[model samples]
Target chain A: MQGTLSVSVWRGGEAGSFQSYEVPRRGNQTVLDVVTYVQRKLDGSLSYRFACRVGMCGSCAMMVNGRPRWTCRTRVSRVASSGKLTIAPLRNLPVIKDLTVDMTDFFDKWAKAGGVFKPTATRAEDFAAIRPTDSKRRHADAGIECIGCGICYAACDVVAWKPGYLGPAALNRAWTLVNDTRDGNGAARLRAVAGDDGCLACHSQQGCQEHCPKHLNPTAAIAGLKRAVAVAALKGRL
Target chain B: MSAEKLQTCLWLVQRISASVLAVAVAVHLITIIAAVQGGLTAAEIIARVGGNGAWAAFYGVFVVAAAVHAPIGVRTVLQEMTPLPNFFVNALSALFGIGLLIMGLDAVSILYRLGGG
Candidate 1:
C-alpha cells in the first residue's frame, strides 16, 4: 500500500537469471498478485503457471525467498523482507521457463511408486462399504488431500540428490492408495516402492512436511510406506 | 541382489562405517590438537608410539576403520551427484577404499618403525 516493492523473478529455464521489477504496493496483496501485476503491466514476456487464483489449485507454487510455497496463498506481507522478494521455479525439476517447471518427471515418479488406485472389485460387484472411522481409512484420510503441488518436492533435498527417487507427494499418494481396502495391488505397490529410488531412500529430512502448504506430513506417510514394504518383503510378497 | 536387499545393505554399511569412523576421527583429532596445544616435541611423540603397543593397536584399528568409512561416503556422493555408469562407480570406490587401507597401514608402520613411537 506504499511506494514500491522490489521483486526479483527468475527469467529463464534451468540456467536463468533473476530480473528485478518494481511494483506499487497494495493492501492484502498476495504473492500471485505481485507476479501477475509484473507480468501483465511491467513486462509481457515473464512466464508463470497458475490455474485457480485461489489456493486450491496448487499450480502457483514458487520458491519465495528460498522456500517453495503456493503464491496464491502466501501473502507478500508474510514473506517480503525489506520489501523485496525473490521468486523462482520449483527446484529438482527441469525448469521449462521462468516460474514454470516441467512436472513430467515429478508425476512419473508417482506412477513408478504405484500411486494409482488398482481396484480389486468391478462395479458389477457390490460396492465396498468402508467405514470412515476405520483405522486404515483414517490413515488414508491423513494423506488423501494432497493437491499435487510440487512444493514438497522442491523443498526435498533427497530428491535433489537422487533424481530417480519417488518424492514425498508421490509416496504420500501411494500410502493412501495402499490403505484403500479396495486396492488389490498392495503387494506389487510395496515392491515398487521398496527399491533404491523408492520409499526406502527417504532420509526423513522433514523438508517436505515443513514446506507443504496443506500441512500434509508426507514424511510420516513415507515412513508408513517403508514399513509396509518391509513387511511385504519379509512375507515374500514384495 | 534384489533392489530391496541392495538398499538394505547400503543402509547397514553406511551406519556401521559411520559409527566406527566417528570414534576413530574424534580420538585422532583430539590427540593431534592436544599434542599441538601441549607443544609436545616430535621425539616425545615417537617415544610414545614406539613404547605403547596399545596405542599402536588403536591406531591400526583407526586406520582400517577410516579406510572402510571414507570411500563409502565418497561412493554416496558419486551416487547422488553424477550420471557415471554404476559398475565403474562401484569399482572405483572399492579401489579407493583399498588405497586408503594401504596408505593408512603405511603411515602406521612409519610411526611404529621409523618414528620409534
Candidate 2:
C-alpha cells in the first residue's frame, strides 16, 4: 500500500486501447477508490459511473481483469497482483468512454424480454393479499433482489454470442414477473422469453450465477422459464 | 413456423439425437472392441455386413446422428460469426447434414461390398 499501483484503464470506446496510470495506493483501497483517485487527482478527463458507493446501486460494475465485478465491493488487494491492475468497461456492451458503457441496449433487451410487470388490479381494487409463504412468492423472492446492475448481462456468454439474446438479467426479471400471481401477463411473458434470443438462447452456462454480486441464480430462473415455456408451447398457450 | 414451436422442435430434436447417439456410440465402440478381440479379418468383417440389413441399419442410424449433431454444432459456431437468421442457417445446415448422411452411408455400403467393413 506504500508504493504506487500500476493501473491500465480503457480510455475510449470499442476502438480505443488501455492507457496506463500510476497512482499512490492507500490501505483498504477498493478498485472503485483507485478509479476515483485517478479521475480526481491524476486525470480529470476519465469517465466512469457510480452511485451509492456501498454497493447497492450496482452502477459501478466493470470488467476487472477480464471478469465482470462490482468495483465498489472489490478490494484492490484481492484483485491487484504485482501492484498492477487493468480495468475496462463491461463486456458485450457499447462503451461510451473510459470505464463507462452504453447501457441502453442492455435495458432495451430487458424491455424486449417483457421485464415490466403488468398488474391485474388497479388502485380501486382491494389488495390481492398474496401469501408470503406461497410457493410462487418464494420462487419470486429468490431472484427479486436484482438491481439491474448489468453485471450478469455483461457476464453472459450467450449475450455475446447471440447479441439479440435477452440475457440472464432480463430473463431473471421476467421470471420474477412470471411468478408474480398478481401479474396478468404471465402467459405473454412466457411467450416473450420462449424462442431463440430469449430464455432458450441460454446454454445453461451459469456465468451469470458465477459473477452476480447479489448471489441471485439467473441460471436457475432461466431454466424455470425454459420449463414454463416448454409446457406452454406444448399446450399451445405460448 | 411460430418461433416458440420452432425452438421447441429444435430442442426436442437435439435431445432425442443426443439420446440416440449415446446408445449408438456405445454400441459402435463395443462392437469395435469385440471385432478387434475376435481377430476379425477384412473378409470376415465383410461376411458379417455384406448383406446384413441389421448392421446396415445400425450404421445408418449412427451416420444420421453424426450428421445431425455435427452440423448443429457447426451451426452454433457459424451463428456467433454471422448474424444470419436461424431458420435460413439451420435449414442450410440440415441440408449439409443430409449430405453427410448420404456420403457416410455410401462409404459404408462400399466397405460392406469390398471386404472392408
Runs with alpha carbons beyond 4 Å of true place in candidate 1? B9-74, B92-117
Q: Can you write out model 2's per-residue Cα lDDT over A1-238, one digit (the tens) per residue?
A: 5999999999988899999999888999999999999999989999999999988999999999899999999999999867999999999999999899999988898789888878889999999998999999999999999988899989988888888888899999999998998998887788788877788778898999999999999999999998888888778787
Model 2: residues with Cα > 4 Å off, grouped in runs: B38-41, B83-88, B105-117
Cα lDDT tens digits, model 1, A70-188, are: 99989899999589989999888899999989999988988988888888898899989999999999999999989998999999998998888899999999999999999998877
For model 2 chain A, where is the 10-residue window of minimal lDDT? A194-203
TM-score of each: 0.78, 0.90
Cand. 1 Cα-lDDT: 0.86
Candidate 2's TM-score reads 0.90
> Chain A of model 1, TM-score against the native?
0.98
Error of 2 at A196 (Å): 2.0
Tens-place lDDT per residue, model 2, B3-117, is 7777766665666788899999899888878777558687777776666767888888888888877777677677776878878888878888889989998977886657534
